[model samples]
Target: MSSAQGGSGEREESRPKDVEAEPAEAAAETSAPVAQETSETPAAAPETPTEEPTPADEPGQAAVTEPPAAMEQAAAPEPAPASEDPAPPPRAQPPNPDGEAKPQRTFTPDFLTELFRNPLDPGYADAAARKAAGNGAVGVPKKILSGVSALTLVALGFLLVVAYQQTVADEPARTQARDTLIEQVQSRRENTTDLSARADQLRSEVARLREQQLGGAALAELQEAEAQTGLAPARGPGTRVTVGDGPSPIDPVTGERSTEGRVRDTDLQRATNALWAGGAEAVAINGQRLTATSTIRQAGEAILVDFRPVTSPYQIVAIGPDALQREFRDGVTGKFFRALNSQFGMSFDVARIGDVTVEAATEPNLRQASPSPQASVRPTSSPSEGGR
Candidate 1:
């Protein structure tokens, strides 16, 4: 019996130790399942690492269990690769299908239109208000000023009427004075006409006396002198040159017909000079005789020969030998005219005439004179007469 009891006590002590060991094994098994779950689901595992702790484990045992779970979570794969592409850029609103963008209206015209609208116009409304207010800005109404002006004008008119009456009252005396002046002018004109007639008669008498006293050679010399001095008309075979303004062309820059295309004074002068150089004895332009002192110049737009205005188409008549035409063609005037024809479309014409007659030039008045020494001296009485 004693041997049996000792064996039973020893078996009971071994049983208690095995029971404690079984609880520890059971805790390890439960922890092994938790570690496996933490490795599989790492994202959730970090949040609750110390999941439900065993009641039998001490604080030190729980601390040790947490480190292994944290290590397992760290070893987990990185989060599923970020979604492949970012959300497509917010789609832009589709463009309007109707039309292009409308332009923004500017401010100036709109502002001005609003400011100058009928009721808002400053000129009308402000002027009316200023006038109606009678604020001394304008001092007096336009009607009162106009009435005063009318009254003043009426007074001036009355004064003018009085002056006119005085003038009318003196009209008879003025008429007598005017009659006297007219009589004096008529008498002077009649005297001048009589004197001119007497002078012509005296000239005719002198010519008759000269012809009777002088022989045929002297008469011929006088005639030649008169012709050379352009005192008598000339008739001969020569050329006629006509220069005229061309049909005007529109100016490119000014958009008007150019006046430069017209015949000028210089052009006529050049033609006259060319004719004279070609041995022209007598030259006449536009029916006016060209004397030694005649001038070809421009006065305003018209050409003046000896101060007399002549219009185009200018006809220059020359009395010379038939060779004048040939000489004129080879002269500077011919070249210049050709250039005008090509460049400005001027009109130049030349023709030979068999019977060309040029009128005589007007006689000139004497401008200066000096008395002879003999005429200036008065004769002294003879010495014999003085002695007597």
Candidate 2:
């Protein structure tokens, strides 16, 4: 019995040991679950995310998840959008609080394209075309100005020409009238008003005719006798002179001066000299006698002979021996006339008159008469005065 009891005691000690080992093993297994839970808690905490996380904080998750999908999409290339403007929406937007819809912009692209394509504008294409074709600007402004200027000049020239023409047209008539006037005045100057000697001669002729109061036959004989006497009629040998103004000096180019042309004083003097050398007894220019008091002066285009105005076609009358006059005209003076015709185109005419009678120059009239003495006492003494 004592041996049995020793064995039981050894078993019991061993059983205690095994029991303690079991508990220890169970504790180890339980502790292993707790450790696993701790590891899994950290992973769940990341998923639990207390707030939104930034990309940097979730980098690892982002890389593993979203990045793979994005990378795959990126691998396929995409085309760029076209430059065309976006189309408008089908529906219009609601009006703003102001009750007005926004105005849409309308493009004028078509109009602009047409305008640019046209070649008529002031652009490079038009300029280039004109240059290549060697064309210049042709329009209204230039032509109008040129035409107006030409017309104005033509009108002005016409006016000037007309004025000159009028002056010339009146010259010939004026010259003729002036010549006539000068002739009358010169004749008056040469005539003397001395009547005393003429009255006495008239009384003597009356007394002689009265004393020859005879019958018809006797009267006829006395008349015949008187006729034979030198005093019966007036007769004399005299020269006839003619002075005339010549034509205007010939224009060297045109060969003759127009009506408006000027006459020279020198030409007048030359004509006068020719007449004198022609043996003219007495010469008168215009109507003025070629006396010492006469002078040929220039007054404008006309000439003045002894203060008497003379125009063209002046005539000088001379009285002298007809033969001598004929010789004078046909001699050197005639040669001069020929030269005048050929060189200067002057006109002249010479003629001889028969039975030329020249009256002597008379004394000028004196008008300052003295009052006649009262004839009351002389009336009775007229016969008594002759006796005394």
Candidate 3:
């Protein structure tokens, strides 16, 4: 019996690791009945109990339970969550005509995502990566080119420094020259004003002498001619018409201001003509007297009267009879201006303020035609000439 037990222990030792993991409790039957020690023929032999060995007693048994990581990997898969927004498909392009195949565009998650995040161009990023990786072997030609480029950049920097220094050095001289020119212009303007005042004084003296020398009829004729020629200032009760620019409404389709709403030279000319027709003795626009030969025309957006620009809110004052306003407002030209006011949102006002003064205009240069020697003779009215 001792030999059989020795063989059994040797067999158990030689078994595989899986068999060693089994608990020592397997030999006992769970349904075995407990013996009752009631003097029944010297109590039956007590049955041995079965108990499993702890993991400390059986080290090889721990290998049967898997690790947490292995358990997670081996777990049954669940359905994937639905994607809220799927990636867009690639953009399509037309087929190449030259048969050189164009690379198909692929969906890139970072194409737009990195634009604002990293605004550097792809070439710049590549250069940065290359620089970070350190430089490789450079050829002789490329090294020479790089040296020359560095030399050129240094030279340009030096040139800019020199230019800036030169400009700074010349600043005082330039300022002095500019000041001299300004002073010269101011002096010339003052001289011209003095000369003009002197000439006006001389002219008044000459006029006084001539008035003294001339008879009543001749003096009266000269004064009337001066008044009519716009060489002398006029003053009287007259109608005043002020015309201003419109609101300058823009065209909705073209997105430009409408020209019809703007005041033009033609409008001033027409108003002046209308006032003349209404028996205006003298007329002026915006304090500038209008002469017979004075021109009213456009220079770009400006309205020039005798080559002098006039701003908006043109005020036209005419010296004429009390019937002057009535004739002008009731005339055909009045209706035309009314149309402009109604259609273009322009401002038109007519008033007769008491005694407005009109300034004298520059004297006009005139060349009067003369009769020939033969044409100057008066023809004698005779019965013989009448019969012929």
Per-residue C-alpha lDDT of model 1 across residues 142-191, encoded as one tens digit per residue: 78978999999999999999999999989989999999999999999999
| Of candidates 2 and 1, the better by lDDT | 1
| lDDT string, candidate 3, 1-388, tens digits | 3332222222122223333343333311210111111113211111100111121212222222112111111111111111211323323323433221111112223444434432323232222222223331234466786898899999999999999999999998999999999999999999999988887888889889999999699998998777767878888899998888888877899999877778889999999999999999889999889989899999989999888889889999999989888777778777777788999877887777679888888544556998766564556554456668
Preferred candidate (lDDT higher): 1 or 3: 1
- The predicted structure with the larger TM-score, 1 or 2, is 1
lDDT for model 3, please.
0.59
| Residues 7-100 of candidate 2: C-alpha lDDT, one tens digit per residue | 2222112111222223333333343233333332222211111122221221222222221112111111111111221323324333333211
- CA lDDT, candidate 2, residue 277: 61
Steric overlap count per candidate: 0, 16, 0
TM-score of each: 0.46, 0.28, 0.50
Error of 3 at 324 (Å): 2.3
For all candidates in order, the CA lDDT equals: 0.59, 0.43, 0.59
